[model samples]
Target chain A: MANVLIYANQQGGNLSSNAREALAFGSSLARSANGETAAVLIGPGAGTAAKEAIAFGAEKAYTIDSPLLAQYQVELYLDAISEAFEKSQSTILVLPFDRKGKDLIGRLATRSSASALTEVIDFKVEEGTVHYVRPIYGDKAYGEYTINRKKAVIGIRPKSHEPASRDENRTGDIIPLKIDLSEEVIVSTLAEKIESALSGVRLEDARIIVSGGRGLGGPEGFDELEALANVLGGAVGASRAACDAGWVPTSFQVGQTGAVVAPDLYIAVGISGASQHLSGITNAKTVVAINHDSEAPIFKRANLGVVADYMSVIPALTKALKKRMGVNTG
Target chain B: MHIVVCLKQVLDPELPPRYFKIDPETNRPDDGVADMVMDSYAENALETAIQLRDKIGGATVTALCLGDEDSEDVLRRALSFTADRAVRVWEDEWENLDGQAVGHILARTIQSFGGADLVLTGYQASDIEEGLVGPVLAEELGIPCVTLASELAVEGSILKATCEAENGYQVIDVPSPAVFTIVSSEKNVPRLPKVKDIRLSRSKPIEELEADDLEIDAERCQPAVALRKVYVPDREVACEFLVGEDGPELASGLAGKLMELKVL
Candidate 1:
């Protein structure tokens, strides 16, 4: 039977949602493969995360607790994870494709001498091989990859799979592992910065996104866009031009090189859709473009186009949305 | 600090699919478009390394890439970006090696190059997006690795970096002679080469190392992974449209049209 290992972590007694997603996905794969699922969690109070993973579907949870892991250090974490993989005899390693996930995949692939597939949207088992489909060329196309080796690893894309509901009756094994600190050497730590926004949903998870572009003119035009987004209960996004001009943080930019979003409703304000920008949100179920430029490229891909100035359309739209949905616009 | 940035030449995605064909057997394209250019994120990583070199004042940047013989074009482009030297790993069937195998081969090459204080790469390859080469190489070399790094600074053996995390951002402290797969950003965008630089790049040394030349396990040479197939995805957007006029004329009628389409 295949042994699937999940590399999970927690700090400050908190586990990331993506980690939960990884456990759920890995559990499903192991169940289907007639195998056992193991989770390797590092840090203090990571036991809470391990318990949560068990409740979801882990056959066993491996904890490597150490105060040194309170902050992420590459060497310490990798050494611990590599040991876990060796000990568990994990043939299939599943991890998230986020920052830590990406790093772990690389290190594990080398240490195990196994092939890796990153950004996998879904997977299927064929004979003894695991076939995975992933986006390539900045999500412009999809590729199907299969691993021929017995030991294989995959990085699951965020939100690609539905999360498993908590099952109180579900129970699994918990194993504790040792963490070695001698290998870890001090390099640099990210200066902790206060979070500016903690209440709103992340841009990737938002169901609706209202974005502004170059046509918004200056930074001031984004105020109206934000108002509309707030009314719609959506996050605000920006085109490359807007981000380049300092209209918004680079994190909010949607393009081939930026964030790839598939929101349910994408409203573009004063944005002329450049092909590069369209590459990011082309997956949106319904796209509405509001721009003064009648011949704008955004109009070509937009399901609905409004040829009006943002100053007039956005405020009116926001008010109408607020009245209809009773959403807090303040 | 000598930094080596490994690059690849890929079929530009914007180009129509008619110009390309994904080989069903190998899962990679077999079309004849080898205009070599560095991958976008690798370019960013190269830019970041160049900036670090400028600040530190004692580092040499080497551009190393593996592909068909035509990959020299990509090597030259990297050289034009002010890399001290360029090397193109030569292979007749280079496309057969998977990401992990590529990393193993690169690790051997890095050892031959005297092992740099730091190595940089793109977070994901545009063609495969496997993103294994950089990390696997670092592992094989027994060094630390950081991926998806947006900001980085190396002082002595310390690598202080900020990488893109799932919820927000993560600060990582890793020791160097490390490897980092850089995220795509315009922050440290690569600059276009001047005429003189381009001319000089043509004369830059291009070393060719064969995959067979590296002493690696024969099993690793074969890909542990295989590609089943590649197909065009189902088009989600309907091409059907409504005929309309400009501005006020359309604005008055827009709401009704949206309602008819059930888009309002």
Candidate 2:
């Protein structure tokens, strides 16, 4: 039987949603293979995370805890995960396709001589073989891949799968593994982590995103978008034009050359819908475009199209949202 | 200081969706469109190396690529941006190699070129978006690897970089002889080559390295994964346009729709 291993990623001492999704997917794979599903939690408080993983579908959880892992150093975490992976003896390994996971998946696959796939949107096991599906050409098409190797490492795209619900009544075995880690491998050390000034939700994780484009005129225009985003209890994004115009940081850019987001609701304000920009948000459930130009390309893709001056439209919309949500502006 | 930047030429990602077509037989995009350019993130990586070379005098930036003769266009473009050297590694059998095989080839190519103090690559290719080569190459070379680096600076043998994280940015310091996968940043915009420099780059010699020259293990260069099929995704949901007399009415109607959808 082919054992499946899922890396349970945690942040701020809590299990990440992506980790839960991986566990769910791993469990499905295990069921199909008639094997076992194991989870590996690496960091300071792995024991607590392991229990959480068990509730979320893991049959066994491996905890690799060490003081050196208090902060995320790539080398240390890589070594710990690698050792845990070996102990699990799994044929298939799953991880979140985020920043941290992306950094490690390729290296781990190379070291283990395993086939690897990233940003996997879906997967299926057919006749005891695993097939992975991923986006290509900036979401213009989809490619289905099959690994020929004995082992495979797959990185699941974040928010692509719904997380499995936690069951407190469920219980599983917790295994603690010990491996000798050398400090010499620690070539890179994180100097500091600067928090973003915008304090609601992360752009990638936000259920709703209010984005502004060049029609906002300048940097000051983002403030209005911010107000709308804040009122909606969501995140703010910007078009490439806005970022290039110095209206917002590149981090806020949502397009082909920027972050790909699939929020539940995406509100694009004063933005002409460019093909480059549309690639990032096509997966969004509902798109609302607010621009004065009636012939804007965004209207073709948006679920809601409003033709008006954003200067008057945005502030009024913000006020209406505040009223509907019953939030005090004061 | 010796720095190596890996480049890949891909179909223009900004092309309209209507123009994109995948060949079912080949499991690849149709090369009908002549809009091929260097991957955006790779351009950032190249710019990062150039900036570092400018900051620390005497640093040599070598641009390396693995593809057919068409890939030389990007290498020449790299040279036009003042890269000290351009090398292309190619073979007829290498056309369908997966990311792991390509990574091994790159590592071998770097080794043949006397190795480098630092290696840089894009976070991912715009076409494949696999994001495997850099980290796999780093492992093949037995070096530390960092991904999603937006800003990078080298001080002596120490490398300091600012990387984008989920919540914010994290400044990282690593030793020399490391690999970095650069993410696009506004500050690291690629410099366009002047017409004179573009003409001059044609005269510069580009070294061609073949698979036989590297003497790589044939087994190691075999693709680990096989592409089963490629197809355009079907758009299942038709866009529904909301109608309203004005801005406030439109906002209210959209909000109501969200509530109905139970996403609010």
Candidate 3:
């Protein structure tokens, strides 16, 4: 039976949504493989996150409760994760494919001599072997592979799987893990963290998104899109072009090199779809395009298309949406 | 000081849908249907190396790629960006290598060249998007690694990087002989190659080696990933046009339709 271990992400004492999602995915994988699932949560909140892991689905949790883990330092976290992996003695490892994971996946795999598959979207079991599927070619294509190695580390893409249901009544074990977080181990030191000015619902978790593009003349265009987004209770996104033009933060960019989102409703304003941009929203359920050019490539993939300038269109659309939804209008 | 930059040649990511054909037998993109170019992020890494080399006097940038003969084009492109040397590593029938295999080959190659003070790679390949090679290579060479970095600074015998994280960004400092995977940005875009540099790039010689020369066992040198299938997903949806007389009417039409469908 495969023993699956998850490197659960947690800070001070709060477990991240990504960790919850991973616990759910990893637990299900273990059960399907006729194995057990466990998680290693590192930080001041390790104890709390361990219990949550059990409620979410893991059978046992390993904890490395150190204030040093309150912030994610790659070298320290990697050392803690590798230690947890060794203690768990699991053949399979899973972690959220997030900002920190992109750094740890390869290093962890090499340290343990395990083969890795990153940003996996799906997996299947056949005769006790796991076959993995992931997006490749900028989401234009998908690749499925069977690992030839004995040990495998998989990085699950964000929002690819449902977060696990909680059952606080379920019983599980919590085991504390020991690791030295001293100054000598600082091969890579996180010197400082600069906060971004972005404030709103995160793009990945939003159900509806109102995205602007370069077609909107300048920064003024985003202000218009924000009005529509507010009326619809949605987050704001931007094409790479808009982000490149310094009209929006790079965090707002939804494209191949930016955030890959799968919101339920994605509204494109003044955006002529590029292949890379389209790839990011491939999983978005319903797409609405409003562009002045009827021949814009976005029309092909959009569920609803409107030919109009966003300058005039956004105000009317926001007004209409606010009216229909009974939103507050000053 | 020596800096090594890793580059990759991939199918054009911007190819129109009409040219996106998959080979029925191999489940891979149909050969010769789409033009190939240097992976754009690698260009960012190359640019970062060249810029840093300029900032630090007497430093050389080496461009390295692992692919078929066509991959040489990326090396030449790197040369156009002022890379001092280039190395191409490949072998007959060595396709679809897993990240570990590629890491092993590259780590050995860097060791053969006596290593470098800094090794830079594109944060992730545009095609696979796994981004394993840099860290794996660093681990293989027993050095530290930093990924998803947007900028780099060289202090007095120290290297610092600015990398993105959730809700913000972080600056990390490490010693030399480190690996860094760089992300692309419009602010630090790759510069256009000059005609004089293009001529000089053609005059430079590329060091080529076979996968066998790395001394990896034959069993370990086989195709890295055993792919069960590779298929393009159909993500298109039918479009309902909202025709109107003016911009306001069109906007209203779209809003009304969305409300009717309960999309808002």
Model 1 spans with C-alpha error above 4 angstroms: A9-15, A178-188, A191-201, A213-221, A239-247, A254-262, A268-286, A289-316, A319-330, B16-26, B30-36, B154-159, B166-175, B212-214, B239-264
lDDT tens readout by residue for model 3, B107-202: 888887898999998888877778888998898888999987878999987899987777657888999989999877655578999999999999
> In model 3 chain A, where is the ten-residue run with the lowest total lDDT?
A321-330
Arranged by TM-score, best first: 3, 2, 1
Tens digits of per-residue lDDT for model 1, A115-214: 7887787777778655688876545457778777778778887666666567768788888886566533544355543242424767877887889999
C-alpha positional error of residue B154 in candidate 1 after TM-score superposition, expressed in Å:
4.7
lDDT of 1 at A21: 76
**Worst 10-residue stretch by lDDT in candidate 3 chain B?**
B215-224
Residue B65, candidate 1: alpha-carbon lDDT: 85
Cα deviation of A15, candidate 1, in Å: 5.0
Superposition error at B83 for model 2 (Å)? 1.5
Each model's number of backbone clashes?
0, 0, 2
Question: Which candidate leads in DockQ?
Answer: 3
Q: Model 3 in CAPRI terms: which quality?
A: medium
lDDT of 2 by residue, B95-176 (tens): 7888889899999999998889999999888888888999999999998888889899887778988987767788888888
